[model samples]
Target: MAAELMDGKLLAQEMKEELKAQVEELKSKGITPGLGVILVGDNPASKSYVTSKEKACERIGIFSDDTRLPDTITEEELLSHVDRMNRDDKIHGILVQLPLPKHIDEDKIINAISPDKDVDGFHPVSVGRMVLGQETFLPCTPHGCLKLLERYDVETEGAEVVVIGRSNIVGKPVANLLMRKDKPGNSTVTVCHTRTKKEDLLTHTKKADIIIVASGFPNTLTADMVKDGVVVIDVGINRVEDASRERGYRLIGDADFDSLKEKCSKITPVPGGVGPMTITMLLFNTVQSARNRLSK
Candidate 1:
């Protein structure tokens, strides 16, 4: 039998509905969650992502402020804008889109956001809090992946999980999350990256009850590499040339879904998979930020 689809789009919609209800409650209590997005340069993909985020905010009844700067913008100018958002009482969450213009210092820009308002959860403080398993904003993508597992009722406790990527954003944080001593966590995790031997990748993946691939390379995880009945989460988003498509390209994940799906118990699709959940988690984090502020 083919693997059951992990419907991230459906789960995201459910979470968004919950957030919308919470947003309404907050509004009734005189609290309106606001998200500030800082975009630099004119990368078409980044522009499209920002637009989608803004639309999500509108749906949830949250206020969204978008700051778009030219490609020529300097690091100092970007920092200035982040600083302003940090102090803006109306804005509870501040997200500076990644892949900043070459001229700007991305680390410095991420550091500029107040920890309380770092909805993107890229700051060191947020990372540190996550490490300690404290209540802080969880990085959206990894958080979303975990949520997907929970919604699907996948068995995580004591399971051997292999995550193929080591980036701070998805791979490492996800490993940290799964290794945590908590529910949906407490699993044995092995994170593999480029330096890892090819034999090691197969060795670990073959034994993994859950495998997450985030290497941004199309078809990186072949069907033969994974064990039967493994739950696969494909976090990679790669654009490959497709002559048939109108744009001459299509989105694909690291896993060879067509071949690997038959070998797995559950798996997520590329476009409708981890992608939607990332945005929904962003809205969830913003709602939490607003609620925390009100409680304080």
Candidate 2:
């Protein structure tokens, strides 16, 4: 069977168009949705990701307050910045770019952001609400994964699903989301982690009707490990050496696309798949945060 692409780029564009219209409507109501981003250091990949988010905010008519800080900034200084944004009436959402300098306490920074403006959904409060299936900002990557499956009309109810990761950001949330008693959920879910035995991991994967891979490494899902006709959503974004490319490197997903494409019913690609969806959902959550304030 020739596998069909999930086409996250296309779906993300559609979602952005819808959000743009919402932004216009909110503007007419004399409200401008705003997002404040804290970017520390100058990591190239993080900078690129932040730029993409800024462009997305512009496209959707959301106001962006992009703040750049030095790598030497103290954790207390970062928290002070977050505190100021938390009190800013114009800023409805706050996002701290990940992989902050090693000297900084990541959890303390994440905890400093108010739950109401925590668009990245890493705050303990947001995570707790999500675990209880309450209204809250969902983490962009996992939420984007669900949105992709929903938009593509994939069957999740009663389906056997294997998630190959355990990270709090993507794996834990997505697993909880898939097993919820709701559409695009209700799947019999199994999550494989680092401690999982190779044989056990393959056994769970081979029987799953859908496999969501966020293993953070390439080649985690091989063709032989899964059964034919399984649906695959690869969330991994790994950089590997590629002399043939102009940049001397290439981006790849967890699943072996070339070998698995012919076997799976549907699959998402590396550069254009989950990556785009993740950023798009960040925009979605920011918009939602702004809208929530209007009703208050």
Candidate 3:
């Protein structure tokens, strides 16, 4: 039998409904949660992502501000924008879209956002707080992955979870989350990256009860590499050639879903899987930030 679908789209819709209600409550209290997105270049992918974020905010009754700058924008100018958002009382959350131009320092821009308003959770402060398991804003993608596991009722406590990819955003933070001593956490976590030997990758992944692949390469995880009855979460979003599609390409995950689904107990599809949850978590974080500011 095929594995059960994780259904991130459905879960995201449910979470959005909760956020919508919370937003209504906040509005009744005279606080409107606001998210500010700064897009520094003309990268098509970045633009599309930002557009999606804006629509999500509108759907959930949160206010959104979009700041678009040219590719030639200087680091100083970018910092200035971030400073403005930081001082804006109405803006509870600030997001600087990633893959900034080569001349700009990504870290500098990320650190510029106030920790309280760093809804993307990319700042060093947020990373440190998350490592300590504090109540700081969690990274959206990894947090969404955890939410997927919880919504699906997948066993995580004491389970061996092998996460492929070691980037600061998804892999590392996710490993930290799973290892935390919490209900949705407490899994024995092992993280693998490019330098890891093939044998080592297969060794850990094959024995894992849960596997999360976010390495960004399409079809990186093969069916044989995973053990039967495992729960697989493919976080990678890669665009590959597809002549049939209108866009001439399609989004795909790192795992070979067709083969892996047959052997796994549960799996998440690429387009509808972690993608929707990421945006939902952003709204969730923005709401939390607004609440924090209001309480202060």
Q: What stretches of model 2 exceed 4 Å from their correct place?
A: none
In model 2, residue pairs whose N, Cα or C atoms come closer than 3 Å (at least 3 residues apart or on different chains), thus clashing, are none
| Candidate 3 residue runs with Cα over 4 Å from true position | none
True-structure lDDT of candidate 1: 0.94
Cα deviation at 30, candidate 3, in Å, is 0.5
lDDT of 1 at 277: 99
Question: Taking the candidates one at a time, how many backbone clashes does each contain?
Answer: 0, 0, 0
Task: Compose the digit string of candidate 3's lDDT tens values, residues 1-296.
Answer: 59999999999999999999999999999999999999988899899999999999999999998899998989999999999999998999999999999999899889889998999999999999999988899999999999999999998999999999999889999999999998799999999999999999999999999999999888889899988899999999898999999999998999999999899999999899999999999999999998997798
Q: Estimate every model's Cα lDDT from 0 to 1.
A: 0.94, 0.93, 0.94
lDDT of 1 by residue, 1-296 (tens): 69999999999999999999999999999999999998888999999999999999999899999899998988888889999998999999999998997777889888889999988889999999999999899999999999999999998999999999999999999999999987789999999999999998889988999999999788879999987899999999999999999999999999999998899999999889999999999999999999998999
TM-score each candidate.
0.99, 0.99, 0.98
RMSD list, candidates in order: 0.7, 0.8, 0.9
